[model samples]
Target: MACVGESNGLTFWVAEQKDYEDVMSISVNIYGGNDYLPHRYSDWMTEPDRVVILGRKDSKLVALESGFVVDEGRTLLVEGLRVCASERGRGVAGEIQRFADQYMQQLYPTLRTKRQTMSDYHSSESTKSLAKFTELGRRAILSFTGDGKSFNGFISHLKNKLNSTTGLDKAVSVQQMVPLEDAHHLKNILLDPELPKRVQLPGGVIIQDWQPFQPIKGNLEILARRNLTWLVNKLEKPNFLSFYTPPYPIAFDGGSLRFNIDMFGTDLDSAKRAFVSHFEKVMEKGLLTGKIMIHVFLDQSLWKEMKEFCAGETGLKLWREYWEQVIMERDVRGGAEGKRESNM
Candidate 1:
């Protein structure tokens, strides 16, 4: 009983158990261009009671969406929704969403169901998605990553930086309520004496550390070290590190580093000042190098604070305009800087 939909030359159909493996393979082939999805699903499907939706055609599968029931059996946990590149933008995703909503309602009438998606931690998407996902259940989690040259290498570099600065040997630890993947890699990094002290949340929820270098003089040294470590670690762990290409394929042109700060950590004004100060230092020294540009990524809360900060302080306002101009010009260049922030 496969439900089907068609557009243009392609068709979409509800996949059967026989179509699962092939559909998975197709999905892996397309989405596997980045490690995030594969890594997430690899961890997720290990659990019992997980349901995955697959799209297929003539016994060949093409796309998948997966989720599980969460909240002591009162809610559905939709990890993500993904479509095959070839089958995308043709209403296949809408069909999948419709099917999923109806299917879950029928299967668990008493349970509230919800879908989740990852968004840039510093962007409006992150905050909005968090709200939407929460409305669907008790607590939906949002995840973020440190700016890195590559994923695996970034973890390693972060580990090294933390080890040197904080004397923290645990490379990976997160506070509870943070929905983060890569806990295994974080734990592994922490186990190494050479890695930074990784802190874990009480219940094994979220994991992270502040920028590793401390004391003003050590800033460049720390940045250089972290970048070098990223390169070295990539060569060492080819499989884990190979998945990401330099976001920019060309040589040092200019780049942006964006990160989200935990607003709950401290006074908003103080945090904004500290971040701006650090960014200025990094820029003045050409640490990013090659006519580098910096763009601060922020959520609505932080964005509002930043806008206020820029308006109130003359120097900060100048810097803000400077970077904004650079970003606009680069947008005209069609360079990597022009690309939208990665969704994960």
Candidate 2:
């Protein structure tokens, strides 16, 4: 492992596989067990584009952060940031982030932007009033909890409702967007000429499974690694689209799967149909089992309508009310004057 630098009495090291256990140990209770580090740390270590940074306070592991180069190395995504519980209230979080920004600049001189995403709760508490960051946009997250059996039952009910829909609704087309198969198609749709006027995307970025990706060939290569389900309304004139990031187990209730359905369009009817279609795709693969936490992310305008439809029309109760994920970015190519401490 390579040592990066020291700051504010904290020493930095390029985290390796050996540091996995310690990272998990310190982050056990983080996010109330919904932490993604434990699940992605192993892969992060092996990914050529990712660098996990460990911060030590007086020789003890006290914090961890990762910077992954994406958007063709023009953007460095800051993720898996967590400071050990014992180190809370101190400036360790900010210091480590500041140090990280500097270190990443040295490692990747081509990086022009630094980006991070946070829960609405955290974003509200952050000092965004400063000129260091730009608020890209936010997606509303509707949550629900159920076991595999319950989810199966819900899907079955949804099929019946869908079957009863009019012929016009049945004609609604949904297609899967794969990397090699649909790379150009995906790029054109995401970076379409009409997107700016429609403003379908927030800041022209695709935040999938909590990772904000730009619509570029390099970014598509990064995304192609995941087992994602992409559904669009049409190949010619697409308006609504959705992608379901396959479920991964979270440390909630012994262990439960976290499934995310990201809907990009504001069409209430299409969003609802795509929601069921994506769930059906998962069910077809027999991936649902045990306890599962479902999170539906969509445009803020469609949150209330989608929530009502899921509960009243689909019979799924809301696990929690109204959570939003805030996506933010800052120019690092000489625009940011000083240190940028991400509160994500």
Candidate 3:
């Protein structure tokens, strides 16, 4: 085993294939028992231009952090940051973060920034920590709960509401989903170089299932690997777009499945149609069971309307209150630590 760094009784090691069990042991009740680390840990081990650093004390796992090189190697996207429950107050998170930053600097000397998404970002020290970071963009997150049995009801309710809207603007002209594997069409839309600044995207950042990535070729290629279902209202210069990531088992509500649907655009009608189409597609997959936690990330303007529609129509409970997933970045220089170099 290669030890990367050791200091003050804590040792940092590059995560190996055999350390999965030990990592799982330290992660308890993370993300309210729906932690994504457990499901994606193995995949992170094999992903290119990524590194998972394990922090240990006396040869025992105490923390885990991962950095994915994105934005064409100029930025390091931090994810799966966790500290052992027993070691929380000992500055474990800060240490692991510093370790990952230094290691990445050494590995990728051209690195200019360290980026992170703020969801679990809200800790007791959220306000103070946030003050040091620059906000890139954020999307409103609304979480709902239902299952395969209630999926059809949810769609029906959405359609019924769409049908009865007296306000002509409530009418959704398009409810049909694009072909799942329309390779040529998807490439055409995504190939647009200006996807970053498009008004459809929040703050010009394309966030897939809580992971914020710049809409560039390298990042787009990274998103392509995930078995995501891409849907848009049109094939050319589309006004509506959404991404549906496959459901995976969670440790909440008797092993419920969690599905993430990221909708981009402010049109209420198109957003409503997106739910119908995405839900139907998920139904066809037949992967859902018992309780399904659906987290919808969309424009803030559509949050209240969509929430009211879903709650009043389908009667699904909220997995959590309304939250915003903001992407924050801090500038990095040669051999930087977790310290704030400058507010970017």
Q: Report every candidate's CA lDDT.
A: 0.35, 0.78, 0.79
Q: After superposition, how far is residue 253 of candidate 1 from its true place, in Å?
A: 16
Writing each residue's lDDT as its tens digit, candidate 1 over 1-344 gives 55645433335554345554464455553311322343335434454545666655455555566645543445454545666676666766656655665565566665543534232322252352243233210111112222332333423333344345445556443111221124344333323332221221111111111111111221333223222211111222211110111121111212233222221121333334334333333334434322222233322334554444433211222222211100000011222522432222
Clashing pairs in 2: none
Candidate 1 global TM-score:
0.37
The reply for model 2, stretches above 4 Å from the true place, is 128-131, 162-184, 195-199, 312-315, 334-336, 339-344
Off by over 4 Å in 3: 120-124, 166-174, 177-180, 313-315, 334-344
TM-score, one value per model? 0.37, 0.89, 0.91
Specify the poorest-scoring 10-residue window by lDDT in model 2: 172-181
For model 2, state the Cα shift of residue 244 in Å. 0.9
- Taking the tens digit of each residue's C-alpha lDDT, what string does model 2 give over 75-126? 9999998899899878788888888888889989999899998887776556
Better of 1 and 3 by TM-score: 3
- TM-score leaderboard ranking: 3, 2, 1
Question: 258, model 2: CA deviation in Å?
Answer: 0.7
